[model samples]
Target: MADLVTEIRERALALGFDAFGIAPAEARPDLGDKLAAALAAGWHGDMDWMAETAERRASPKALWPEARSIIMLGINYGPDSDPMAMLARKSTGNISVYARNRDYHDIIKGRLKEVAGLLSRRTGAEVKVFVDTAPVMEKPLAQAAGLGWQGKHTVLVSRQFGSWLFLGAIFTLAELPVSEPMAESCGSCRRCLDICPTNAFPAPFQLDARRCLAYLNIEHKGPIPAEFRKAMGNRIYGCDDCLAVCPWNKFASETREAKLFAREDLREPPLSELLALDDAGFRALFAGSPIKRIGHGRFLRNALIAAGNSGDAALLPAVEARLGDGDPLVRGAAVWALAQLADGERVRRGAEAHAGGERDADVKAEWAAVLPEVV
Candidate 1:
């Protein structure tokens, strides 16, 4: 059994995973209770799937009854530069480091499948692998596997690799000996909690996805709520403030995966250039990038919010051009941008022209809503 575990760990490292561990496939008794509390508090927000797969997600045994052991892996993709610096550069679109290169879902899934195939051949063990796309409770599972503890930010923070790990899991019918679970090392540290722009953390180790900029910019569809827009600053994709402030990050090695390297173009894209993208243009710009999955409408909505917060009056022309955009989401975001860029008079005049022709109820309310704030 020790030989099998040693072999699996060695193969994971050779395959580009920075860390590896194993956990029993038994159901975590506390996971289901914590999940129920979070759902009851509405912290899961608009991600309805969390509620839908509650039973399966909380229990590995429930997810795969035959699974007797689980293997956990981490890929370190730490940034070469300070991710927080981009926030002050309001003219540029701040894309999270993870999305600046190849979509990790594709990259990690391919690697997991490769390793799973090898393991199945070696041990004749039935195995299944997963990245983030599934309902797996990867953070807790990874902790139980001795990979890392869940930091106050609710992300896995490895003592060896820090906050910059992308996690994946494999379920196998073989009962490999379990590794000792990682101990909590976040004693007397609150940098992650203090750094949140939207006050997303209700307490240490808890997050409200409804107020999270990462959630708003990515998973969320339609117009962003007014309260979170300005706090979002120039971030057009996701937020990383909490992760960057972690002291554990110093131990993280630079990403070895060429596919995960930050793309020069996405590092700090000019907000004006990002605003120029129409539907076809958006698709072309983000092709093969995870940003493409959001589609043009939602992407444009985020770009427009960044434009409004940009404080660049020069962006007014680009903001106005979207008033008549085909998508209501884009148009609503544009209206908000206009209210921010232009003064009360210009915004009112622009609203009068578009309000009559604009058919979407949300767009109409958007123009109606912003008028009072500027006035």
Candidate 2:
């Protein structure tokens, strides 16, 4: 069994995985209680799927009854430049490091299958694979497998890779030797918590996704909450403040996987260019990237918020153009963004031309909020 584990580990490294380890499928029995508490507190916000998949997500055994051992693999996607610095370039949009390249699910899933196939052929064990899309609770499982420990910010932190690992898991019927679990090592470091623009962390090792800009800009389907708008800064797609500030990142290096590196156009795309994206243009630009999944309307909504926070009066024309967008979500956000860059007279003229025909209550409310005198 030890020899087989060694062989598997070698194969994983050869296939480009930077970290590898095994854990008993049921290693984290405490997950169910933790999940229930998080769900009960409404910390997950609009991500209702976390609550819906709670039972199966609680344990690998519950997810796959035949599974006896799990392999956790990580690929380092560390950025070559500091993502935090991009936040200050207010005319451009800031994308989270993870989404700046090709979608990781597309990259990691095939590698996971190849590794799982190797394990099955050696031990004649049935196998299953999962990426972030699955309700696998991968961060905790990665800690159980000794890839890293959950940092105070609740993201897995590796001594070697920091918070930059893209995690994937493989479950198999073979009872491989489990690796020793890593101990929490974030002593007195509050950089991640303090750097959050929206105070997403309720306490150490706890996250309230509702307050997280990454969740608001990505998973969230509606307009971002008003309170978080300015703090959202120029982050149109996702925020990397917490992940980029980790002291553990000192030991990390830029990723060797070329596919994971940020594409030149996406690194700090001009908000003006992004604002001009129509559905067709958006699809063509982000064809193989993860940002495409959010769809055109949501993309515009996010860009409009960034425009509102930009304080660049130059974006006024682009902001006004969206007042008649097909999606009310986009139109409403445009109203707020225009209000930020334009005077009441200009806002009133926009409301006069666009607000009268607006039927959506949300868009009307937006106009009313900005045009209180007219209303």
Candidate 3:
């Protein structure tokens, strides 16, 4: 079994995993307390699943008692260009580096299955593979396995790969010797905290999902909060300010995975062009990518916020066309965008023109407030 574990590590390295480690399937004793503290404080806003499955998330034994060892793997996907460079162009939407290419879940899951299959063949043991999709507490398990320590951003960060690596794991029935855990290296560093545009991180290691741009643009189902909408800037998808400011990223290298590299179309797509996308157009543009899962209505909802923040009159027409969108989420976002473009009289006229048959109370109220002389 020990020799098989050694061979697995070697195979993982040969297959391009930047780091590898192993830990027993038993839960970490401290996880329960940590989760209790996080949930008790109301830090996980709107992420009800995290609170509901607290016990399962805290312990691997509770999740799957039969699993004896966890094989953790890391795949680096750093980009060649500075992720922050696109923020200066306020008219162009900034998609996070991880989402700029193929979804890591697909890419990493395929590799995890291959590795898990090889382990099963060698040891005659049952195995299950997981990326971020499962109930497994991958970050805690990876830390236990010594792949890296959980940094202040609450994501695993390595000295070698920095925080640019995506994590995956394989749980097997065979027993493997565990590795020593890595020590937390982010001593006195608050660059990730100081750089957040919306102050999403209230403390060093905690993240409030409500104010998080990633959550707002992706997980959020209704109108984005007005307070954070302007701070969202042209970030139509995920925000990378916290990730990009990490000092450790300077040591990271460009990804060798051609599929994970930044696509020119996503890097700095014009807001005007993005707002023009209908459902079918969005599906075709983001095919095979994680961004596709958000659907056009939710995606355009974020794009409308970006168009509003752009302060560019050129996008007014694109925003105006969506005033009557069937989704209240889309219509509300269009109201916000139009308010940013039109002044008192124009806004009044625009609102009156669209007000005749509008049914959504939110959109009608927005129209009433922006009437010509009211501005």
Please provide TM-scores, in order, for all candidate models, with all chains considered together. 0.96, 0.98, 0.94
Candidate 3 Cα lDDT to native: 0.83
For model 2, residues 1-375, the per-residue Cα lDDT tens digits are 899999999999988899999999989999999999999999999998999999999988899988899999999998888898988899999988998888899989999999999999999999999998888999999999999999988999999989999999999999899999998999999999999989999999999999999999999998788899999999988888888999989777743455467899999899999999999999999998899999999999999999999999999999999999999999999999999999878988999999888899888888888986554
Candidate ranking (TM-score, best to worst):
2, 1, 3
Could you tell me how far off, in angstroms, the CA of residue 132 lies in candidate 2 after the best superposition? 1.3
TM-score of 1: 0.96
Candidate 3 weakest lDDT stretch, 10 residues: 366-375
- Whole-model lDDT per candidate: 0.88, 0.92, 0.83
Candidate with maximal lDDT: 2
Q: Candidate 3, TM-score vs. the true structure? A: 0.94
Tens digits of lDDT, candidate 1, 1-375? 787678878887887899898899983669988998999999988899999999888888889989999999999988888999998998889999889988888878888888788778888989999897777899999999999999999999998778988999999998788889998899999999999999999999999999899999999986899889999999999999999898998887533445367988999999898899877888888888999999888998999999999999999999999998888999999999998999988998888778777778888888778764322
Candidate 3: how large is its RMSD? 2.0
Return the candidate ranking by lDDT, descending. Answer: 2, 1, 3
Model 2 weakest lDDT span, ten residues long: 251-260
Return the TM-score for candidate 2, rounded to 2 decimals.
Answer: 0.98
Clash number by candidate, in order:
0, 0, 1
lDDT: worst 10-residue window of model 1: 252-261
